[model samples]
Target: MRARLKRLLPRTLFGRSVLIIVTPLIVLQAVALQIFYGTHWEVVSRRLAAAVAGDIAMIVEMLARHPGEETLAWVTREAFARLELVIRLEPGAVLPEEPDPRTGPAEAELAAALAERVRLPFRIAWPRTERAVEIAVQLPDGLLHVEAPAKRLFTGTVTVFVIWLIGSALILFAVAVLFMNNQVKPIRRLAAAAEAFGKGQDVAPIKPEGAEEVRLAAASFNRMRERIARFLAQRTEMLAGVSHDLRTPITRMRLGLAMLTPRLGEEDRAEAAALERDLAEMEAMIEAYLAFARGEGAEQAQPADLAELIEEVARKARRNGAVVTVEAEPSLVVPLRVDAMRRCLTNLVDNARRHAAHVWLGAARSVRPSGGAAVQITVDDDGPGIPPEQREHAFRPFVRLGATAGAGGTGLGLSIARDIVRAHGGEIALEESPRGGLRARISLPA
Candidate 1:
């Protein structure tokens, strides 16, 4: 029940805020209308009905006391001029056996007032005229036919009250929506800036605005963004210095070893060759280390064709003596740091090529778990797949699984691929491939 209610709720702060403002307003107005109709409106209607009925009763009594042609003519003129009533005497007419039932509050109130004051058998017809009610009262010598204006028993206040309620509610709702949109704009801007920054896109600092709490949050976000930028800059510079310092000595050592190889004894020549191989391996490891430590380093995300990138990675793997095939949807475009994404795909492809005889790459449009549009990239190999339990462990830096232990690698391939993918606000996971090996799947938001 709680979950169902949550699903029905507004998904954004602006919508929820309007609901909060409008709900109580509606309820309060409804209560006010109830009280008005139950007391003040009803009382005014009853009083109006009583006054009209009392005037008609007085005319009936006067006619009964003085029954003559001259008196009748005088009473008709007085009733028309003073009471706004049209009256006539039918010499021997009879009342209807059954009168029509009262259907409205005004009709019901008028009928009750006549019953209490007139004290005579009569029938009322609302259809006698468009703007009047016909009342016929039975008398000893004749029937008294009276046509009373409908306004006598009904008040204009009810219509005016209803119009006021509706007009005021609409005006209030419109004002609340406009005010809330202004209040929510700054928060929306903050959220967008944070998402862009996470995807490695450059974002300018946003100005603080709106209420005090929103302004404070925006200010804090700007400060945090600056701190992170400063830290990344410092780390990138240190990594560059380390790469240069380490490579210069390794190059010199390789040159010196080449010079000494020819002068060594036959057995010593084999030892020198072994030492050279170790040196080359150390250099490769250092390169991998620096590349991993440097991260994506100041690269900005821009629109790129993911399909083209996959084909490029496949082509490079083919040149490196690995059999590779690519099947990608054309123009599968998304924002990416081209070089960083290229390196990331290269690592996955290279790692696959070392152990498998065949590799396949694919890219296509997809959807993220949260229902957003996304692009999916897959790298598949026919080599022995990692155990399900060990796949996650393989993504830990320098932790090669037992299945991949015999595979010659720096053991940073999966780790580096994951880091790069995540920096682009994407996810990478390992799963069993239909090709009977491992599948490296990547999902990036479109």
Candidate 2:
């Protein structure tokens, strides 16, 4: 049953909003109407009956002015035509008895209203009909019994109440929709804030300006973001300082080795050459750290064809004797931080080249099954593939396996590439390539 209701719900925000607002209003108004009928219906009917009794009193007061009983009855019927009013008097009490059953439905309704009261509009019911001879039976203390038809009076009162209920529900529904929209605004703002944070973009603190819970959520999110930003800043500063200092000492060592190049023995020269190789590797590691540690770049997003970017990266790899091929369709533009995305794609292609003899780059625009345009770019290589367990593990910074450690990588390449792609609202994954090697699949917005 819950599943059925979920399926029936409107898929769009506006439709859901309208349904949420209107459904509760209709139910509440219906409940209120039932309550009103249960508690106050008798009171309203009694007040109406009392007014009818007053009119009947006036009729009795002016009865002497009439020429006869027949004329007086005619006058009474005409006066109470629209309302279910009854008039029957008992000996100088100056009020009507309850309506006679022989009369109409209106009279019976008026008579029923006085059923509980004594010495007022007297008791009335439909014990018998068809005998138009209206009876004025005597009760204790000069009370008179009266009866009339009940069906018409019941119908008339119900009609009026139903009209009132419908109008009240409509007015209430309008007010509810307005308030619901206002209440939902903060939720929408919170969602947008989360999306911005996901993209590594700066989201301004949303003042929880709605209900107490919404305000609390916004405050919590803002506080968490501030703490994360501070942490990232301090960590990046420390790494940058260490890398810079290490590079200075290494530069001095490289110069000292150069100064001894002429006097060094064959084995000593070989050791010095190996030391130079170590220095170069350290330099590369520092460069990788600098690139990977950077956060969201303050570049304006612009539409660019991801296929074109992949092709350019592959072309650069080809010039360096790497057999990289690109296959893609053109004119598929998506919003991107161009510089960061370029670095990310270049690193992935470069990694492929270092791993495999043949690199193939392919791009295609695909849509997610749940609905969203996704651009898929793949870099496949024909090298020994990583195990399934290690595929995801290798994407982390500074994690190197047995074979990859000697491959001249800082191990930050894949991690930095994944980070940059995620910042653009995209993802990267590793899978078995057709070449029996690793295939890197990157998905971005289209």
Candidate that would win on TM-score: 1
* Cand. 2 Cα-lDDT: 0.73
Q: In model 2, what is the error at residue 335, expressed in angstroms?
A: 1.6
Relative to the true structure, candidate 1 reaches a TM of 0.84
lDDT of 1: 0.90
Residue 156's lDDT in candidate 2: 62
Off by over 4 Å in 1: 52-80, 85-150, 265-271
Candidate 2: tens digits of C-alpha lDDT, residues 1-446: 99998999988665687787778877876887788766676556556555545554444445546646686577657655754445454554433544444465345446654443322443344455442213243433343433333442343666787887788777876776777678778878998888878787777888787788888988998899899889888887897798779889989999998998779999999999999998889888888888887654555567887777777887888888899877887877888887888888788878877778899988889986567999888889998878999899999899876677777788998999999888888889999998778899988877
Task: Tell me how many clashing residue pairs each candidate has.
Answer: 0, 9
> What pairs collide in candidate 1?
none
How does candidate 2 fare on TM-score?
A: 0.67
Q: Which ten residues in a row have the lowest lDDT in candidate 2?
A: 131-140
